[model samples]
Target: MKLVSYKLKQKPSTLRVGFVMDDKIIDVQEAFLQLPGHSTEMEYMLPSEPNAFYKIGIPAIEKAKKAYTYVMENQVEEISFHRDEVYVATPIPEPSKIICVGKNYAEHAAEMKSEVPDYPVLFAKFANALVGPEDQIVKNSKTNKLDYEVELTVIIGKEASNVTQEDALNYVAGYTIGNDGSARDLQKRTPQWLQGKSLDNSTPVGPWIVTADEVGDPSNLDIHSRVNGELRQSSNTSKLIFDIPYLISFISSLMTLKPGDMILTGTPDGVGFALNPPQFLKGGDKVQLEIEKIGRMENEVIEGEFHY
Candidate 1:
């Protein structure tokens, strides 16, 4: 099931499961309102917590499905919503911390002239960096070299600590596309990449979260980035030196991972920095990050004045 957080006309945003029926998004909440005993279930399921969807939302959806199935059999009022009319928010909009893996791909490591760590090289982006699909990524003049890194993001489902590689997948709730937008100049000035990576609204995260069951074998998908309709980074998760399970276990050993915490599995080669005359993102540029099965995320780059 493809789950999304969205806002409908004049309504506050809420978590919803999306289904493509007749090429329109089936508004699960709207359909649920028309069902008997759904109100109670919705109240119990719908919460601000990221893990609530798995704990309560899925079960509620299952119950609603039976009602929806019956309604379909009887041909009740058609439930459909136009895609453009709805506003999509991040699947887990307010993650506690966005943990990212650096140099997980050998080619990416080589391009940056860094040694591939035997263990995962972890960094973090605060919640302020998070943005959803269709959101604008501001390009401030303070940083001249803006780059994009397309990565597979893992959303944690349960609280985990000291997890083994074998049991790591169990804690993952779903997967989403992450663009680790970087300020190349600032990133290179310091050994730590935090300042360059954690800029406000730098992380363009989600269109939807494809459940782990739906996106089996996370390392086998294609991940790529396109700037202004031109493909720049094209590679597969198979090229990742450290796969998802190892990443989760490695990080979990250092710190506990709670629901809503995201782990960016790292980007592939072909970043603008690797180019001879390095093509960096400028104002008015559009970036598209696509991960197979998880869908694509597009964002516009707007020029902004530097502050501080």
Candidate 2:
């Protein structure tokens, strides 16, 4: 199932939770209401936001599946909307923590002139940096060297602490595409990288989240990036220095991972800053990222003021 957080284009003020079926989006709450035996109590069970939907666990997913099945079988059109009728937002807009991995690809580490790390190199991004696929990636005044890193982001399904590598994938809800926007100049200025990595509205996260069942093998998938129609990065997830299971176990050992928490499993090579002449994103540059099973994100870099 491809779960989405969206808003009707005409009613953009309120956020809605839904799932993609063919080219149409099915409103979860609306569809659930149409179910033959749905009760008032069940109405409260469904959430209007993706974050809350994920927190409800398998029961919520089961209810959504039932709703989709019933709606499709009975040919319900009142609860369905065309893809263009709604604005798709980040699958988890306000993840509790946006934990990111750095230098998880050997080639990426080599290009940056950094050694391959023995452990997963971790960092964090706050909600302020989050942006949907339709939003522009802001080129703020803080730095001139804006760069892009395309990463396959994992969304946690349940609370996990001290989980083993074997059971790690069970805690993952789905996968989505993420562009870790970085201000290269500011990143190198200090030993810590949080300042450059968390610029407001810079990280373009998702169009939707493809459930883990659909994305069978996350470790062996194609990943790529392009800047204004020109391909810049192309690599496979097979080269990940720390695979998904290892990363989950490693990260969970440090702190608890809750539902809707994001884990960006590092970017592959061919980033803007690693080019021979060091190409960096400028105003009006369009950035696109794609992962095999997940979907693509096309975002433009625009000269904009930071929203305080």
Candidate 3:
């Protein structure tokens, strides 16, 4: 099911959780309200935490499904929503930390004249950088060489520590598209890429999160990025030097990964930095990132005068 967080016209201040059915959202709460005694379970699952669903939402959904099924059987209400009316938020907004992988793709490593690391190259972005799919990515004056890195980001489903590669995926809640927008000049100025990467509104994520069951074999998906209408990067996740399972296990070994924490699996070759003249993003450029099965994110670049 394509689970999403959105604000309805009736409740603009609060986010509502629901499954995307056709065009209309299958209001999970409304569905439960129609149920006999599952209202408490719905309340328990209403916390903004995405992992709560696994602990409470799923079971509640299962029970509610029975009633919904009956409703469907009886033709109580059709499952359709008008796509244009709802304001969509990140499937999990305000995640604690956005962990990102650097140069996990072999060709990407080669393009930057770096060796494919035997271990995963981990970095992080602050939560303030997180924005939903349609949000604008600000290009500040400090960054003349703005670039886009299309990546497959994994959303953690539960708190994890010392997980094994074999059991790593079990900790994953789902997957989403992550555009690791970077200021190449700033990134290279310091050994740490944090400054260039963690700029506000840098990480444009979502369209929506697809559950792990729906995105089986995460490494097999096609990941690509385009500027305006031109394709700049196209590669499969299979080219990843460090796959999802390894990343989860590796990161978990070092620190605990809580639910809503995300991991960007790195980008493919063909970043603007690899070009002879380095194609950087300017104000008004549209960046489109598409990951097979996950979804697509289209962001417009706007100039921000302040530079740090």
Strongest candidate by lDDT: 2
lDDT for 91 in candidate 1 is 71
* Candidate 1 ranges beyond 4 A from true positions: 9-22, 27-44, 48-80, 305-308
Name model 2 segments beyond 4 Å from true: 42-44, 306-308
Per-residue error for 130 in candidate 3, Å, reads: 1.0
Per-candidate local distance difference test: 0.78, 0.89, 0.78
TM-score of each: 0.86, 0.96, 0.88
Descending-TM-score candidate ranking: 2, 3, 1
- Residue-level lDDT of model 3, residues 1-308, one tens digit each, is 56677776655456666666566666555554555554565444344333344334234335445545655556446443566767776666667768999989889999999988988888889777777765788887778888899999898877889999999988887788888989899899989999999887767888887778778889799988999999999999898888899999999999998777889999999999998878999989999999998778898888984322
lDDT of 1 by residue, 138-187 (tens): 77667899889999999887788999999999888789899998999988
| Candidate 2 clashes between residue pairs 3 or more apart in a chain or in different chains | none
Clashes of 1: 0
Report the C-alpha displacement of residue 9, candidate 1, in angstroms: 4.9
Q: After superposition on all CA atoms, what RMSD does each candidate show versus the true structure?
A: 3.4, 1.5, 3.2
Which candidate would rank higher by TM-score, 1 or 2?
2
Pairwise lDDT winner, candidates 2 and 3: 2
> What lDDT does model 1 reach?
0.78
Question: Residue 70 in candidate 2 has what lDDT?
Answer: 89
